[model samples]
Target: MDSEKLIHKITEKKALKDSKELLDYVSESGENTKEYIRYKTLWAMLQTGNEMDEETINDGYKAVKRNVKGRKSSLYINVVKYAAIVVFALLGGYFIHFADFNNEIAMNEIFVPKGNRTSVVLPDGSKVWLSNGTKLVYPESFVGDFRNVQLEGEGFFEVTHDKDHPFIVNVGKHRIKVLGTKFAVVAYPDDEQVKAELVSGKIQFDIHLGGTGDNYKSLMVSPMHSLVYDKTSGKVYDSTIPDGFYDYWQNGVYSFKDERFDSLATKIARIYNVEIVFGDEELKTRTFTGTLSVDDNIYTLMEAFKIASGKPFEYTFESGKIYINK
Candidate 1:
């Protein structure tokens, strides 16, 4: 096939009867013929409203080269480049013809570092507030019959209502199923317990344990209720918690009711992005019941704890660590 006729066929998106022969001619052609074919083909595609990125063309070239191995002569190189353009242009046309190709599922991951919190609005309009050191994996768009996401650390979700498409969160060994509900999930990988606190609506929590006869168990949780699953004991417990207690951290408030200092220290360390070392063993058993604003500096927050404890407390910060002594 002549260069002019080949370019015309490519631009018109018509099947070439002698595609191999045309490829051979382009590969054996002189520098002038090769350049003319390359530029003319590009201009024709542009005129036909076909735009392609360099990366996509390069990827297509690599894909074709991987299937056919040998020394890459100038002829082979030119043929590869031409093949890449053809493949990419055909793919662009295919995407244009099938609208659903735009909706192909893609996974997106978000990480929130220590001392910082972040919020994301999902493709379905559901909002998620991620706590410090949290990792969330979600789809770019919902497909199939349900919407699902995976969570690590902690997150507060205000899911949009879609009764037909229930939203599911997979945290550790537990799965939370909900249909338009506000809830908070605390399932840090380092923690021994996973807790799901419902702010409104209802959620079903499923625990999966392999090998046992009653390996799978489901618990329905209502508003104002918190479901706690102990990984060590393999037990699930439900308790009534103060409304919004789970989500207070979203607003920089750390609320605790008779929380041990040991556990509180962990929260403080995560929120302040520091390590807490207790110099006095007795401080670990000390219980605290109050709300502390995380917006304050670490030293100020520690001072509030000292005042609440009514004990002589002192702390030193060094090397990104806080040494608490009494």
Candidate 2:
């Protein structure tokens, strides 16, 4: 295909007959490769008008052969660049897409560093707010029977309603299945427990059970309720949580009701991107009940703790860590 016509088809989001050739042409551009990449990625968005039906395109290596009799195009594979809005997901800032050359299948990933947050819009128009120290993985497009995503750390999702395409979030051995729901997930790989809180819509929390791993039980979660599953014991703790507690960190406000300082240290570390050490074990038992703004300096927060405790304790910063003592 001529470069001009090939480029024109892409702008229209049409299926490509020679996807490999397109990549070769792009790679041969040398110094202009970056520009070419940006150009192609610019049109990555799925369009509404004059759109090529997805069934016309063959994606992935096996998919090409499976759909050979019905294929209209070879493969419509496009590279995902940093900060590009993809038909799969609107990934802003630092993001990476890994693909298999044989198959047009690409796995997209986004990481939010400590002390930061990112918001993304999926192709289905579902919105996700990723918390600091979080990583989310999804495909270049929703394929097969379900829309699957892997989440590590924490994220808040306002999922678009799609009865046919159920949105499923995989966190370790568990899964949160929903059809148009608002929820928050806390499932850091390093943590001993995983939690899912439903904000508005309903969700089904699937917990892996039995020794063989095939046995499982699904619990329907209602709005304003949270399910915390302990990793080792396989215990699920169901409780009611305040409406705004799950998403308050997005606004830089940390609210809690009589939560222990030590219990909250790990979250604080993620917010401030620092390590917290308790020099005095006694101080860890002290519970705090209030709201804290991320805008406050570390010292101001320590002072607030001092006021809450009604006594003077010592806090020092050293070795990129904060040490609190009595």
Candidate 3:
């Protein structure tokens, strides 16, 4: 089968015949090569859908194993190997993480350009999910009392536990410190608000008023709570995480609820890698509430937003840019 057909089978999430055809193709492609490995991972993910639980994963593996038990063939071996890869990749979705080893303390930076999101396993084995248009900087390895890292955009972190070696994330004038935890930080330099959401564990949030770091306010953020700091007014707003919001954006979902169209446009611009110009300033004030898949057409998304606002929205694409009018 061709690449398009194979992707169709995986995405359609349909019958087993499509999966068997893909399996046959992979087995014939030869030993655990890159191509075979890729297919195997996809096949496993497809079998269980995009999301899976512990029980679902277990049952899916056993069922797959049963299909090839009597054969004792190489296909069975390939399936087993694929199963292992899926268990790991699907834990956070399919992504490739590689660490560059350098003996020197030279700083390395990973910049996820507009229109793409990426995940990295840091030197300490902590994983970070970077949203589009984000930059992360750190040393090649950790060799100090603190694992210091800098962030210029939004990122979700799952920090590895280390009591002696504390992990600190520096976001401009503000900083977040943790021993180990899962949390998200949104500190885009241009944005007026810097937001932090703690999913689990405790984190210390510090806001510095000066370069000396002497005059700073600190607070502890508990699990399942979130805080947003307004950079202009220097006011902090605390609230519970809103419903239908999650780090799921790492997996291709651009979800929002009752958000302004202009803000939505900015997010779409980042992911679509496009510049947007609005002919009517009033359009920016409109609000939209919906979930968008990164795979959906940008124009279609715009139309949906207009429909939600009940406004006359029109757009034209030219010179690789989007011009919107009402």
Candidate 4:
């Protein structure tokens, strides 16, 4: 077929008589013609006001086959051309017509470094507040059996639950299942423990870290409840989380009730992107019980600790390290 004839057929001005010749021409056309044929045929098939039949659909496949594989140089290549056309046809259909792909898909990822905070929305109508040095992966659209997302570092999730599709948040070695619930996750690699604090509704916490992973059970809880799974202890501690603790992230406050200095420092490190070294082993082992506002800089937060402990902490802004002295 001539170039003009090809264009006429693509423009739908001329009817496709021999689907074989049209297919061959599409298969051997140059890059520009190949793209034109691919998009034009796609638009022809999918565009509103057009009723696509088998011949036009076959032409669409032929267009994709030609565009994806360029020109064949051998007889064997020609023999396999039909199979390649079928593959491209199915793949193109999935890409353009798949409903799941059209909705809540994670198209990009955002990372929040330590000493920072970020807010993000998932494909579902859920909101997530990512704590410092956290990574969240989500789709641009939400489809399939469950609305799921993977979380690293720490984050607070306010999920908009769909009864047909449960929202699943995957933290390191732990999974939170909820339909519509608000909760916070504190899990850092440097820390020996992971915590999930529920603010409202109910959540199912699955402890996936154990000798026999399948032997572990799931714990269901409501607001003011918490589940702390410790890796070193091989235990999941359930407790009534203290008031004001759940709102810490939102209010720029961090509350610790008799939490050891080492664990507390780990949390601070993730939030502030700072390296805290304890000079005295005893001081590092000391436990702190109080509430400090993170709104101020690290120095100010340390000052609060100093008054509570009756000790002074000297930190160097240049070195990003802190020292406790009595």
Best by lDDT: 1
Off by over 4 Å in 1: 1-103, 211-215, 243-250
lDDT of 2 by residue, 48-143 (tens): 211122432223223434433432343222222111233223222334343222244345566767766656555566777776688887664576
**What tens digits encode model 4's per-residue C-alpha lDDT throughout 52-147?**
236645675566556554455443243233333334335433221211211212133445566655465454557777667776666545567888
lDDT of 3 by residue, 166-251 (tens): 99999987899999999999899999988889999889898887667457899888688898889999899888876545635446
Local distance difference test, candidate 4: 0.62
Q: Model 1: per-residue lDDT, tens digit, 202-292?
A: 8998888867554668889978889999999988888997744754744578778898999998898878889999998998889989876
Q: Where is model 1 poorest over a 10-residue stretch in terms of lDDT? A: 94-103
With a 3 Å backbone cut-off (N, CA, C), the pairs that clash in candidate 3 are none
Task: Please list the residue runs of candidate 3 whose C-alpha ends up more than 4 Å from where it truly belongs after superposition.
Answer: 1-103
Error of 4 at 282 (Å): 0.2
Model 4: lDDT of residue 27 = 46
Selected candidate, larger TM-score, 1 vs 4: 1
Query: Which wins on lDDT, candidate 2 or candidate 3?
Result: 3
Give all candidate RMSDs, comma-separated.
15.6, 11.3, 11.5, 16.2
Count of clashing residue pairs in every prediction: 0, 2, 0, 14
lDDT (Cα) of model 3:
0.69
For candidate 2, the clash count comes to: 2
Relative to the unseen true structure, what is the Cα RMSD of model 1?
15.6
**Residue 175, candidate 4: C-alpha displacement in angstroms:** 1.0
